[model samples]
Target chain A: MDEIKEIMLDILEEMTGEPMVKEDLDLNLLEEGLLDSLDYVTLQLEIEDRFGVLLPPSEYTKEELDTPRRIIDVIADKMAV
Target chain B: MSVRFYDGFEFFVLAAILSAPAIWLGVTERRIRGYGIFASIVVILFVLKDSPKSILLLAAYLAYELLLVRLLLYLRSRGKAGKGIGRLVIALALLPLILSKLAEQLNIGGFAILGLSYMTFKSVQVIIEIGDGIISDVDTADYVYFNLFFPTILCGPIDRSRRFSADADSVMPKSEYLQLLGDAMTRFMTGVLYKFVFANLLALAGTDRPYIYGVYMFFDFAGYSLMAIGLGNIWGIKTPDNFNKPWLSVDMRDFWNRWHITLSTWLRDFVFSRLLRSCMRAKLLGGDRVYQACMCLMANMLVMGVWHGLSANYIAYGLYHGVLLALTELYQKKSGFYKRHKNETAYKAVSWFITMNLVMLGFEIFAGHII
Candidate 1:
């Protein structure tokens, strides 16, 4: 589980090329407060590759990501599965 | 000059002549894409001086795959299966592809090098799987089949390595070949119907509005994807679906997932997840969950934004959904408004919104840029 988180962080850093230092879970994805959608899907794909968990299209409902903490738990759950 | 120029067209004639032999080998010997490359060779031959594009693309992919094999071998040699080196290995492998495709969209000249964009995605995806310990080992024939399969040549529903190799290694009876021939014939006819009848009848080429153009594009592309998938299916091979009801997705992310199901899944597994994980870990060290989710969503979208291209709109197009996902994440966390409302009706509505917006907007952007 820890390894998966470690892997996830490594993947996130490589993809974003930016530090996540001091950011909040519900903070806007874009520096400008409006995160773009295409980037989101790209991120989802990257997560799948890094973790080897296949995402069904239905998994990505708006309610899914509700918070950063929940997101990690979700990812952890998927990785565990 | 004219005679020399005609030399290129002459190759097509030759390719046609050679295709028969390839068919015989594939059907009789059951060689699959092993013999399919003879067809690829024909395409490459036509692209002669165009060797720069093919050579550059081929060398990069070859080097990437070879390095991947070596790293995994080394890791196994060191008995390091769960060591997490696989993540870095995949990152290293896919970086070139993401860069090259992005460069092409920027019109950086060489990035649009023929089949480079699609093929690179396939190989890179394969390398990641191999590194992750998901894929154990595959024979040479299977590897060849995965890379060189012809039906998937021009555009693709990028076949997974294991799935592709499995199909290649297996054999079907002669009756199956006849069925495939019938299916191929029917599909080819559909392609003809779309190209000659639907595309031209609708005069789809005469449009700028994405919604209108989207319909035509669907027929045009679905036609080809169908033909390819049909050809594969009949031959006792498999292909992942390239499209579902894409316009039906309720949000940008959903739309992307549905639109090019194969590419979307490939990108999600390899690229998007990494971005999210890094963001969550780096900044949110026990920070608010909603806050971190947003940060991850944003970071992910930015990479996706760039992955699509260096263009203003293409980048915006990527960011557009990235923003929505982040907002949606934030929204869901902050309010339980939609929580109790969850039912089939609500689900369908949301799905429709996402799909419709993507179809309406996506077609517009591609039409604006590509057309």
Candidate 2:
């Protein structure tokens, strides 16, 4: 979980050009402008490459995978399944 | 007769006279709603003067959007909003703009409305955001203001509702107002220089026709955007910029980011992102993500192109850039050489030269030089 979290944060920072703190994990990524659709796509690619878990982009929404917390949990569930 | 620098001069004088009270209110008390309202009226009148029939077209379009949005909201309040409903609402919102473009192509001649494309973009955004539950509170007055904000009425930086309203409703301190005043003056003056002097000189440049025309257009459009941003600042609306130093871009994607910054960003957010997501979910490209992305890029750019006009050249220009962007992405991904040499000065210069020529060729196509 921590490794996934680290990878996601690194991608977020790269995409947004801003650092992400722990508190940012719970915030609405889209609303806060921390992530956009393009960034979301890039993040998904990064996640798939790292975890070997392919999360279909259309199967989720910005609202669904909006935060680092939510994203990590979703990935964990997908992996479990 | 199109509006010119001389008319712009008169417009400034007239606008100052009409908006004096609003300007005073901002300076003395920081109030802006009165200014916003007055500014909206001025633009409406200005546009009406340009083409009186546009008023009717605008009214009908606005009526359609407002009714559709309210209806969607009511349905959502009743817990009836679903993906199908959302798609339907977006389609309806797009109908007028689509029809206007189609009518122009067919020479039907009556469907044209000033700023219809920008209005459609804003309306679609409102519906999508509302459907997403991102925006729950919709004020009629604010929506109207966003629709007809004077500076961006014709060509736009396409300010978002939430961002626009925040600036629209805020009270800037006297110090900040003074700073804003200085900034506005600088932008206005620079815009005037770009449009009248530099662009006009380039237009005169039988020195080399195609090269001059391409670069001239950059100045002309950038000048207009700067003027709009300047006026917007004075009116207390923080209109976002549309251009950066686009000539310096090293790739198609980089060029897009710098040139027409707002439109490209809008298409990325609202069009490409959504299209890509849907394709991925449907497994449309048979699990090859790169191929999927390439197809999505073509689709997205083609839509953007058609938005300019339903013409062969425009579509080709869009497809050209789409292919270039996709190929650039593929190269960046596959070529380890790019990763190593990308940071070097000589490599960057060579890349920039290729990107600019490609962009110039696209502009030539857009200018209807071919077909």
Candidate 3:
């Protein structure tokens, strides 16, 4: 879980071009403009590459993957399965 | 003698009379789904009675799609749903709509079914979801009701099957139903004002001007959408909203998120997202993310435009927005200045101004002004 969190933060920081802190985990990535439509897809792609878990955008909504914590949790859950 | 949905005062009067029982059930906290379905059938029959051709077409279309969906579900249950078969079924489901569009383009008569496009969207969504194993079972009555819900039969805010079923299957509390009724009344009245008063006035004021036409389009379509939503609420279905403050959008992408929201989101989900995922998986454009994104946007917008109609003007309108969105995507991602000061008020104001003009220009192309 810790490793997943670290890697998710790193991916987000690279996409947003800003350093992400632990406090930013609960922040809404979409509302905060950290991710737009394309960036969201890219984030999923990066997660797929790193974690080997594919999250189809259609299956999961924007809200389901909105926050950094939620993203990490979803990825981790899929990985566990 | 084809009667348009939500068109005349008589239609609303008839709708009110037909919906009275369902509304009563809703207010009394009774299950309204059965009555709602009955009312929808009543309205659909009345609307299509004058046109035998349309009634036949609609019936045939419904039967075809329902059977197709059932077959797909059966296949999925047996664990024999191959990707090739799934894709073929989707294409087959789209065949009627594609043929209808082609017939219209060819000036052939007898294939013009009202609400075909919206119905196709609902059917395709179900098929895709079932293929993905998201939806396990589909009740026949619920499927029919979801597809033919009269309020949204002609035009739509395009409610999802799962969401619609959840609302339909559950009973709303009296207090909650009453609150929804009040909101529904407000939305319906506002729709009346928008469609009958404002849109009519705009039309009378001359839609020859591009900006006038654009605003007119909003009032007219949004008015229809509001009334549909209001009616859906009365029937205990929380129909999705179709518009927000689109005129104030800060970019092309933002505009899409605001305008005809359901359709844009539908395309985004089923078309754009899927397309992008496949492209990225294939490492298309040699793994160039920007180019891949641009290509997907263009293809997505073209599908949208062609969905409108196979006309030169409509194609141009779609491509125009595609270009604008691609450009917006590029600017936002690549511009250093944009990154530095994007959150500032002045920058957003300028962006809003630019986006509005570009939107109006697209509307002009849609209206066949510049094509």
Structure candidate 3, residue pairs in collision: none
Clash count, predicted structure 3: 0
Give the CA lDDT, 0 to 100, for residue A27 in model 1. 41
Per-residue error (Å), model 1, residue B348? 4.1
**What TM-score would each prediction reach against the true structure?**
0.66, 0.84, 0.95
What is the docking quality class of candidate 3? medium
lDDT of 3 by residue, B217-272 (tens): 99999999999999889888999899998988998899999999999988998898
Poorly placed runs, candidate 1 (over 4 Å): A1-81, B1-33, B47-60, B80-88, B98-112, B174-188, B200-205, B250-254, B274-298, B328-336, B342-355, B366-371
Candidate with better DockQ, 1 vs 3? 3
Off by over 4 Å in 3: A1-7, A46-54, A73-81, B1-3
Could you tell me the TM-score of candidate 1? 0.66
Chain B TM (all candidates): 0.75, 0.94, 0.98
* Candidate order by decreasing DockQ: 3, 2, 1
Task: Give the proportion of true interface contacts each model preserves, from 0 to 1.
Answer: 0.00, 0.24, 0.52
Query: Clash number for every model?
Result: 56, 0, 0
Weakest 10 consecutive residues of candidate 1 chain A by summed lDDT:
A28-37
The best candidate by TM-score is 3
Which lDDT value does model 1 have at B255?
A: 65
Under CAPRI classification, how is model 2 graded? incorrect
* lDDT (Cα, 0-100) at B232 in candidate 1: 58
How does chain A of candidate 2 score by TM-score against the true chain A?
0.81
Using lDDT as the measure, name the better of candidate 1 and candidate 2. 2
